[model samples]
Target: MGIVINQSIKNTIITYIGFAIGALNTLFMYVQFLGDTYYGLVGYILSAANIMMPLMAFGVHNTLVKFYNEFETEKQKSQFLTFILFLPFILIIPFSLIGYFGYHQIASLLSKKNFIVYDYVWQIPVIALCMGYFEIFYAWVKVHLQSVFGNFIKEVFLRILITISLLAVYYNFITPIQFVFALMGIYLTMTIIMKLYALRVKMPSFQLVIPKNVKAIIWYCIFIILSGSVANLLLEIDKFMLNFYIKIENIAYYSVAIFIATVIAVPSRAMHQITYPITAKLMSENKHDDLNNLYKKTSITLQIIGGLIFIGIILNIHELYKIMPADYSEGIFVVFVIGLSKYFDLILGNNNAIIFNSKYFSAVLILGLLLIGVTISLNIVFIPKFGIKGAAFATLISITLYSLSKLLFVVFKMKLYPFTIATLKSFALLIVTFVLFYFWDFGFNPVLNIVLKSILITAFYLGLSYYLKLSSDINYIINSVFKKIRN
Candidate 1:
């Protein structure tokens, strides 16, 4: 818990600061500087790259973390690291060859719905390759329990750079075409920096000697690739489908809505960086009790935080949209559906780490792939009927259903549930706070109104959470901050 809380706190601050930069970029910079069409293009490009990322990395990122500590000998661990590093090339080579031959074919098909996408289609695989190595290096550090720098690079570095780039874009320093290519440069640069940091954390021995457990590791990587791809697809494919179903600019509308909602995931992302390796280590030692305790604490703590974020987003969603362009205001439903789905994902805590690191991980491949199928099908059926909102609905349904399945699987087989009495109470508090403040408009300028409402919401919500002691962890942290203030 000490390591989890310590790192998660730093990670949360970093992630939110990144989000602030990103919000500036997303809400103001992108909309004003890049405009809707190019913004949607950026959204589509990154979403497509994210979908391709798990494939290009071939799950080495996850495999490294989950299995790194299982080996007893330092020599053996080095060999294992060396093995996974090269294993991705097995998939990367063939995928690259295929893309080389079929690049135009892909561009043609993608262009069928939106020809604007055709010329930029090649950047997807390029960024995906960059992303693959980035995660691989990131996992390298996480297994060493040094996630702060990686999280900073992951969350903060790129957004700050993008902020600068958007400034450049605004001043006509680069064309949109160059801006798109420059994003690939940004991802590649981040990956290179992370690779250096990962090396400093643990200089790889780089032995050609494969670990004795090569078969098991390879087998795990296979399932991981599928499961990881499933997860990425769930998060990313909505934007891609929008490229198919509606005008590309609609993807920008969807992006803004998704960005507001995705903020709820900050705590979960922060927590998972430390939890993944920890969960893996705990499972290896067969520490079921500690694992379950961590599971519940994670659930309650995240629910408290996520509930706050959910309340903030949903309640202020209307006001938030008021500051955006008029066309963007139509995505209020998109924000609700996707934001609630992400909050549901937040309450999941470390369920993914538990399942992915468990022996039943292979079984999860079936479940994840099943959900992917359902996601695509839902998108196919619904997008034409509902436009970008339809895409959001598809994602909401897919993620909610996928989360339920994972929760049930973990509870039934592992007898671990993340919910408790406090969980239900926190949820109830969230609802009451939302209902109370949502209709209580400030009736002033949107900016001032948002400020007053947010401050009031924060005070009211945190006061109640503190009064109920929904999470001793959060309460202790709050008290510590107050003590520091007094000092």
Candidate 2:
């Protein structure tokens, strides 16, 4: 648990740093330099690539992580790595070709405005392939218990590159189209770097051994593909649907709010990165008690951290939006809606990982697919009437239901419920923080008020946490930092 907390702290810092850069770029630079249309295009391209990523990688990223521990020998591990690396190429080439030949048709289907959509079509496959391979290589490293570096690369490196690209556009060094191309190139470069780094640690030899359990590996990979695609769809289908049903420019507005809201999930991502392989190992050894404790601690800790972020965003969203362009202010409701959904996710903690690694993973995927259908249906019905806000509502409902379904499955089937007294206490703290911060008025200057109120609100939250002893992990971290400073 200490190690998980330590890694999560490191990853959380890196993620926030990257997020700060992203906030600058998305709120100020991109919105100011690139018009809404171009900004939306960037959002669409990335979302589309993410939606396509699972298929592009053919689920090898997750499969590698799950199967890595099963192999006993270094040679066997190397062969497994080699298999995952080469396996994606089989899908990549054909997928790229399909994307190439079907590019215009896909573009036409996506948008009615047809404003330079084809210009960036070529980048989609490239971005998808890069994202796919990056996940694969990152997983390869994660299996070796080397996650912080990958976290840095994922949470910091890519955003830093995007920040640079946005700066180039702001300086008029590159046109919006060129910036899109540059973004594609940056993803490819990052993938190559991840691959090289993984190789440096353990050169993935191309030797294929006739494993007795190769059939099981293949089956696992197939399951991963289905499960991964359904999961990605749950996360990303809304943006893709927006591109279809609404104006492409609206994506930028929605994306800005979604980014702010998604920050609440950062701690969960960090914890999951370190805890997932651990969960797999525990499950494999039938260590149910250890797994249950991990699940409980992860849930409570993430809820604590994610609750703080959600409160920060919700309480200060008005001031935060003051920095953005005027048109984006309408996204305030989206932020709240999506923030709640992400909060639900955080409350569930490592439930998804537990389900994915469990024997009932296929049922989980089937349920996920059902939720995807509900999400799309809700979007279809609500988006026409409510626009971006409607999309946010649909997301909130879908994800809340998704979280509940996973929790129920884990409890009913696996008898794992990650709830404790701390969970209730954290929820109480969240409500109190929101109430205290919500009605307080600090003055006319949104920025100044936000800054002052945020400081006050954060201090109050921490003070309350100390009074209640809400989080030993957080207390330990603070005490450790103080001890180091005193020394």
Candidate 3:
């Protein structure tokens, strides 16, 4: 718990700083510098690449984390690492061949609604390869329980580079198209840095000896391709599909709203950096009691923090929108719907880690596939009728159903639940705080109003949470901070 909190706090602070930079880019820089069309174009290309990343990596990223501790001898571990390292080429080689032979056809298919996407289609696979390898090496460090550097690279490095690229665009140093090209270089640079850092942490001996469980390793990688595909698809598919239905510029609007709502996820994202490997370790060791305790602690802690973020976003969403371009203001409903969905996901804590490492992962894969089908169907039906907001509804419905299925599977199959009496208290507090704060605001600039409202909300929520002792872990941290202050 000490290490988890320590790293989680570091990861959280780092992640929030990254989001702040990203928010500046997404909310202001991209729109002002690139215009709506190129902004949407960049969004679509990246979303498409993200959807392709898991398949490109061949699931080696996940497999490494799940099975790293299985081998006893250093020789065996080296063989294991060497094996997963080359595993991605199984798919990468074939994917590259298909791209070479069928580039125009692929581009034509993707650009059915928006012809601008045709030229950029080649960038998707190139960027996906970068993203895939980045995650692969990131998992490499995580198995070593050294995630803070990887977290920084993953969260902060790329955004900072993008900021530089955007500045270049503003000063006439590069065209928007060049900026997009520069993005490809940026991703490649980041991946190379991560690979270097991972090697420094633990260089594989490059032993070619295959582990005895080669069959299981291949099977898990195959399963992860499917599972990771569904998961990434669930998040990014809406943006990709939007390219097929609405105008490309609408994606820029949608992306802004989604970015604002995504801040609610920062805490979960930060905690998962460390908790995932820890959860995998616990499940591998068969420490059911510790795993359950960690699950509940993470759930309430994230709920407490994530709930505050959610309230703050919804309460200040109007003011936040006012600061954005008026054309993007229509996404207010999108923010609310997506914000609620992310908050729900945050409270699930390490549920994803539990499932992915458990025996029932295959079952959840089937459920996920079905839910993605439902998501696509809902998107098809809704987007034509309701526009961008329709995509939000589709996502909300699909994610809610998917999340509930995962929760129930864990409860019935593993006899573990993430909620407790503390969960209910946290929920009640979230509701009360939102009601009290939602209807009022300081009559200041949008930025100032957000700051003032956030302070009040943080003070009120954390003060009451401390009084109620909702989480001893959180209370202890509060006390520790106060003690340091007095000293």
Candidate 4:
């Protein structure tokens, strides 16, 4: 728990900082500098690439985390590393060939509603390839219990580079066309840097040898491609499908709202880096008691932290939107629905890590595929009537139902649950906080109001949470912080 808290805190800070930069790019810079058309173009390209990333990596990233511990002998470990590294080529080579041969048709299909997308469509697969390898190496370090550096690079580095590019565009130093080209270059550069860092962490001695669990490894990678694809689709397909029904610029509006809501996910994403591998290990060892304890603590802790963030976003959303461009104002509903959905997933706390690491991953993958179908159908029906908000609703519905399904499956199969009295107490506190704070206005500038209100909310929420001892782990950390400050 100490290690988990320590790393999670550090990663949370890093992630939020990155998101701060992203907010600048998404809200002010992109909206001001690039305008709606270019901003939406970037969002569309990236979302498309993200959807392609899992298939391009052929699940090497996930497979590395799941099965790395299975190797006993050093030679076998090297072989395992070597095997996972090259496994993606089986799909990558063919996919590249197909994309090359079928580029026009692919671009035309995606650009049906917006012709601007077709111009930058080729960048998607290129960026996806780089992102795929980056994650592959990222999982390499995670299995070595070293994730801080990778987390920094993943969360902070690229955003900083994008910030630079965005500023260049602002100053007219580069056109949006050059910025798009530079963006792909940025991804390739980041991947190269990540590959170097991963090698420094654990250099692989290249060997053309079969790993111990070659069959299981192959099967897991295949399953992960399916599962990872479904997961990424659920997350990014909203933006992609928006291209089909609405004007491209509406995606820019949707992107802003989504970015604001996505801040709630920082804690979960931070915690998962360490918890994922640990959860994998615990499940493999059949340490059910420790696993259950982790599940509940993480759930309560994330619920506590994630709950605060959700309230903060939902409460301050109006002020946040006021600070955005007038055209983006319609995203208020988008923020609320997506914010709640992300918060719901937050409280589930490593349920995904458990499922993906366990033998029952295949079943979850099937569920994910069905939900993707549901997501697509809902988007098709809803977007025409509701516009970008419709996409948010689709996401909200699919994500909630999908998360609940996974939670039930974990509880029924493992007989482990992630709820406690603390969980319910935390939920009640969240509701009360929302009811009290949502309507209160500081009567200051939007910036000042957000800062002031956030402070008041944070101090009040943390004070009550500590006083009531909602989570002993969290309470201990808060006390420790106070002691350090006092000293």
Error of 4 at 170 (Å): 1.3
Q: For all the candidates, what are their Cα RMSDs to the real structure?
A: 1.0, 1.5, 0.9, 1.0
Each prediction's whole-model lDDT (CA)? 0.90, 0.85, 0.93, 0.90
lDDT of 3 by residue, 1-487 (tens): 9989999989999999999999999999998999999999999999999999999899999899999999887778888988888889998999999999999999999999999999999999999999999999999999998999988987898999999999999999999999999999999999999999999998878887778899989999998999999989889989999999999999999999999999999999999999999999999999999999999999999999898899988888899888888999989999999998898988898999999999889999999999999999999999989889999999999988989899999999999989999889999999999889878878789899999988999999999999999987789889999999999
* Cα lDDT for residue 374, candidate 3: 98
TM-score of each: 0.98, 0.97, 0.99, 0.99
Worst 10 residues of 4 by lDDT: 204-213
* lDDT tens digits by residue: candidate 4, 1-487: 8778888888888998899988888889999988899889999999999999988898989888888887777777778888888888998889888889999998899899999988788899899999999999999999888888888988899899999999899899999889989999999998999999999998878797877567888898889888888889989999999999999999999999889999999999999999999999999899999999999988988999988999988888888888877899999999999998999999999999999998888888888999999999999999999999889999999999899989999999879899988888898899889898877998889999999999999999988999989987789889899999999
Which candidate tops lDDT? 3
Candidate 2 local lDDT, 340-457, one digit each (tens): 9999889887897898788898887788889888999999998888989989999999888888989999999998889989889889998989887799977778888887887898
Q: In candidate 1, residue 352 scores what lDDT?
A: 94
Instruction: Itemize residue pairs with steric clashes in candidate 3.
Output: none
In the range 262-305, model 1's lDDT, one tens digit per residue, is 99999999989999999999999999999999999899999999
In angstroms, how far off is 471's CA in candidate 4?
1.5
**Total clashing residue pairs per candidate?**
0, 0, 0, 0
Model 2 RMSD, rounded to 1 decimal: 1.5
lDDT of 2: 0.85
